[model samples]
Target: MRLWLESAVAGTPSWCLYNAVLSVLRATSALIISLLGVSMHGACVSAAGGRLNSRQRFLGSIVVAWALVPVPGRPQDLSRVEQLYEEAQSARTRGDFATAERLYIEVIRRAPELANAYHNLGIVYFMQRKYEGAAEVLEQAIRLDSKLGPAHAMLGLAYYELYRPEKAAKELQAALRLNPSDTNVLIYLGKAELQERDYKAAAKTFEKVAALKPRDPEILYDLSLAYMKLMLESIGRLGEAAPGSHQFWLLLAQDAEARGDEEAAIRNYQQALRVKPDVIGAHYGLGSAYAKIGKYDDAAQEFKKELQISPDDWLALWKLGELALRTDPDQARQYLARAVSLDPDFPQAVLAYGRALARAGKTEKAMEQFQRVVTLAPEEDSVHYHLAHAFRRLGREEEARKELTRFEELAKKKDERTQQMARRLIEMTRAAQPLADEPEPGFSPSRDPTHH
Candidate 1:
């Protein structure tokens, strides 16, 4: 029975190592029942009794079907082993670890080469938190059937529980190669990589998980942690490589901007420009910081300086154009035209250019740009709003009304999306509340590996 079951399962088209464990179990059960009689055990058949059942009872069907597959050379001994294996599975499911352990050991004694028996025993040990025993049996399962992805995944998890991150990562990676879509294995691999201080690898692994589950707050949080760790690691390396350099100050300025410290960002940007007068982003960063603080004149001057340094800077052109819209329509048109010419696909720039055209009393030309904006951003409420205003200016009242209605619908959906995002953030905060009492970990630049 053991040999027959193994051959039936292991022979499944290309061995199907990438299949989920449940699918393999189901297929093996179905094939065994189809090829051999269903009533190998009268009790199992009577219990099944052609009635609908829960998943637990459905899983029990494997036991009934497995006992019927003929074994070579030792039919009597193998039938006893099969019965014991089924009993072990039942005990494991019932949470009777002691009985399950004894039955599995007896099954192993009769069928020493049954890799799935070892795998099941490993699962039982794992369920009991006996990581050492689980690891031992899982290793044996892998030795017997090297392509057993579930065993590899379980062994990796066991190794992780044992605090052997290097081994865990290796086995988890092996499992992922066999079953690339296994998010659980990917998660464990990412954690193991993080524990090994391989921030880059951890970030890459977590990014894959995030792609697979974009809306999962937990995965997204872990991905953010990985990216934060990777950033800190790079910052530590950068400090060691070029302390007090313009690039270092530039990085600090950008970090300050992201943290909403406009004053600090301005100071750092100035320092960076002082260090390297022609640095690519220093003028632009300073201009943005000034604009954030409502210093329009200073922002314009800084943006002009950036244009002088990099003549085709589309962002600088767009910012300059936007600033001029309320003051000088002619200057705004020139800047916006150049900005649009440089980056035609930039929806924000295009939208701003349309506004500039509208302010210049070129309603027809403005409508053309609005059409382009609509094509570029059909779902954008602002796009529809501007289009509706243009329609009103053209005296197309019905079209204007339709556009306004579409704008309101889109705006409501946008608000709902924003509310949903806020709810997700709140949920994430609640999930993290238990750790609020924990002391926050500090990063020490001096402890960086790159530091002397």
Candidate 2:
């Protein structure tokens, strides 16, 4: 190749030089094949040349040959671009960012339309936490190759890091369209939906993720947070729509419930229903208050009403299952099973369903449910206690003992956390306002009333 360049300096035409180089390359390939005792057509540059096969040998030789010679006036020197890309990737793997950046930038300069080069350079910028720079390069990559899913993904992440959720969502949706089963794209889409306060959309998106990777606490937690925010936003919107209607009173009852005023909350919720019998959320709020006060029968009725109004309410189903657990295992099993089927990752509903399964003499099935509960909510003491009981019932003494020990440890930690939280609440209350002027009247004396 160097000799060909020397001849070029002696007034050889570029086309003639290119033909001479091609002839020399073919001669070298034929000589090497003969010397290595391998067929020139089916070679792999290995011992006896039985390794990488024809396609690999062909591509490998092309890469080597391209690195040794510069092809001018071509649309793209793909071999040179791929070789540089491989070198950049090697440098990136070793965390040599400077080398990677330089090589990738050079690849882009040589092949200005190389999407992979721009994509990798964007990743290098992202690794350095330069989100703005990543966005710029990744956008260019997307322009070069609209089907480049990874470029869209990186651009979405960059936009997210730059606090541009709408753009992030758009780019993530594009990426997800290209690569439908990507968990990272789904997670980031959920995050963008959440940041935009599209709670229902976020919950639905996270539900797909939860189904894909069950027992992932982070996904479950995000789903739960979305549900909670959706609930709060619903109430807030209801109040905004009807300032003095039954919905507004229902909001007040919810506030009362939040303040631990179960009896008053129940009364307020009842009044709300009386004001507007078909009011949304009133029945559920009343049911929750009744459940808080241990009025299981009353709670069950209210939940039944809510379920009639909204047939797919998993929370209503869960409450009904809880109300029937001690009295009717068959009925509890039906409700809890349906609740679990509706929202399979729901930890509390799963715990209740496990208890019902145990009552129905399905010991192994009960154990499975309890184990799922542990996976879903390892911090919950009730699941551990019930699981220990389930293990004992199955005569798994060692497993039972382990669960009991875990339960004890978790209970102690939970108690300490509760105490700390209580103290913090008291301090916050003291700092919020003076003692509420000795507490408002008509508050129930037994907020945590024991079941009769």
Candidate 3:
């Protein structure tokens, strides 16, 4: 029975376990033969046979002789942990933010020390517009990996969104310290400084960004705005009695107009133009501002002056078209057509041309212009709504309804102006009525309203 058990153990598939059992049997037999005072050569032969049959017998004999054997430690199972982390990363890449967040939470629960999971989860929260939740998760990430620059940067962004500018500044500064060349961090720091009204610091930050990205128009525009703001603030500190004060005020006006501060900005621009009639930007700025304030006649005169200086100024032509639209649709069409001829991709010119056609009751032609706008920028809900109205006027009820539905869906993601236009379009299309009950005193409808 003992021999049978030994043979069975030796023949097992697990060679290491089989060898272990053989080593035990051989050691016991060798000890028994030594105590019996029999010739040990036969016992040594039996042990040699066991060693020849077993893989680990030689190593086990050496270990037993030295009394120095290593005990195997427990194998770690990381399969579940690995699977959760992988799922979290995959979900985030696909923009499935909710699922990504849940998976990240699971990973954190299973492996509390996984800093990357917390960081990624925070990013998902940020993408979902959950600023407070993002802040919390990112804060935890920072605790786990205090030196992680990305976590600091993200925490800064979250704090900025939460109206915690002071904390945002600290985190952003830390991120910058870790990666001084990060343009995005620099831009955020500048924005945070601007929020804190630290214009000087903001200017310095933006200057660094501008240095890194010299030809970026947006950065230049922002830098220009900051300079203009500083100039205005400087002038505001001085009373009118300050020497050369007119020049200061004119400079302030030019800067304000450049930044789109229409009314006061226009006054300053006009002042600058009056003081130096050859100032081109001042003339353009004054004309554009006049058009914005609905002073069309004044705008037309200013634009004419601008054209005298720069005959091919497309902006002047577009502004003239916008001014003409309120009074003369035909003339507006002419100016807008000129602007389009100069720059076919001009969105403002396209919009104005569509408005001109609509106002003139040329609904079909109006629709062509609006359709062009949608083709040029499908994201523009106003263009869709305008096209819908044109379709309704042209008696294409189904197309009009389709465009109106599309406009509403797009409008839900729109700003105030576009939303208002979409709502007006919806009301008009649903009521199936004209905007006006009677034609204006001298103007006549180009087509019968009842026909549509």
Candidate 4:
């Protein structure tokens, strides 16, 4: 049994587990049981097990270990054990883990079958960072009461700390099956999945957490990282299977666009179009990149080509409408009206339509569109800016002033948000860079227990 547990720990990558669990353990104490301790007899029993592939020997040892626990003979002794258990619970709550550990040992000695005592003991061992002890006790706890979800979760966390991701994932999954809404367990399981390189499963797990806490930056970051890993895997396979294909160029263009390399994006997107002119997104991507570089005529031509391929593309129509607003307001309105009708909930299209209406000398209609944009995106600075202009044109001075003030406030906040995002991007890039002292590829260093 000892050999099996050590092998399990040795099989996992320690660095991977360290990175996976460090971010998650911040809220671990709050998520786990309040009462906890480790059983002395269980620890002593699992201390030595050299027999490998001998289930009969392991089972016999377990039976002997169980037989060694002292069970009380009277009801009064049982009541005394309950009193001692309560004292251990108090000690654990007060952070006196030593006293709690001692009292819990006494409780287990009196009532050997009490799974909660073992479960609580596992929690104490976990808190003390004695993960081997924690795993042993938690396993016993689970064996005694298979339905104990907390025990399962605690055991999984211990396995994670011991660098046993496969076992950790299994136990964490079991815990989730018993309580699907346990977000902390879900987080641990997601990290374990990530360590295992199961990117799709990790993404799904993080998505569930995102659904529950939509604004959590850590959860969002994990989900994005998982998706980025999945994208890299897919891109690798695509490159191996279809080198220099139009799809490959299109993917590269989209990646360049996301990285804000508009010039590279335009080049790749054009290559995609040259390879397969009828590809769905190639023209639009090329046009967008062209627009970013101030080539409006080129952008307009590409947008028209995109429309030729997909006549009902609302995004293409919206781009054309935006490009025409500076030169031909009436033509802009024509294109934007169709775009807005196709996707009325889109704030950018509605805002552009309002701008075109204002330029066409239709102030009332423009004001209506601006109001609608505000409802669709109240926090959007440009929407408020356009609404302010509409109000000023209508001689509503006070309302225009209010809208301008709101626009200024939102613009400031938007600038701060952009700066924050830039900082986060830098941090993420730094995290992905190879370490200065990293070993060469294909090199394997001897395991260092002190690394944990």
Which ranges of candidate 4 are over 4 A from the true structure? 1-117, 177-181, 326-346, 375-381, 394-413, 416-452
TM-score of each: 0.68, 0.48, 0.46, 0.63
Write model 2 residue lDDT over 1-452, tens digit each, in one string: 12221121111124345457767876775666555445444445565535666765666676445445545433255566667778888787677888988998987787776677788888778878888988999999898789888788888888988989999999999989998977878998999889888899999999999999899999999999999899888888887888668767777787688789998898888888888887767787888888877887888999899888888888888888978976898999999999999989877788789888887889889989978977866666556655666676667878866776666565555456544443443344325443321110111234222211
> Per-residue alpha-carbon lDDT of model 1 for 1-452, expressed as tens digits?
12221222221122124235445766777665644335545333323355434553465566664544533222245456667877887787677988988988887777776787888888778778899999999899899889998788889988988999999999999988998977788988989988888888988988898888899998888788888888878878898999889988888888898789999999999998888999986888898889989999999999999999899998899889878976897999999999999989876678778888877888889889878877866655655655666787788878877776666565555556543443443344335342112111112223211100
Name the runs in model 2 displaced over 4 angstroms.
Answer: 1-83, 252-452
Q: After superposing candidate 3, which stretches have Cα over 4 Å from the reference?
A: 1-251, 254-261, 358-365, 415-421, 436-452
Task: Predict model 1's lDDT versus the native.
Answer: 0.74
Give candidate 1 regions above 4 Å deviation.
Answer: 1-80, 106-114, 177-183, 203-215, 222-224, 326-330, 416-452
- The local lDDT score (0 to 100) that residue 200 gets in candidate 2 is 90
Writing each residue's lDDT as its tens digit, candidate 3 over 1-452 gives 12221121101023355347656866765665544333333222243343232434443354344332322211122466667778877787777988988998987776675666778887888878898998998898889779878788888988988888888889999988988877787888887877776777878888999999999998887777677667656776663556344466566765575566788978777666666677655566677678777777888998888889877777888888877876787998888888888878766678778888788888888777777877766666666667777786778889878887987888777566656665775786598666642111111123111100
Q: What is the lDDT for 62 in model 4?
A: 51
Clashing pairs in 3: none
Report lDDT per candidate: 0.74, 0.74, 0.70, 0.74
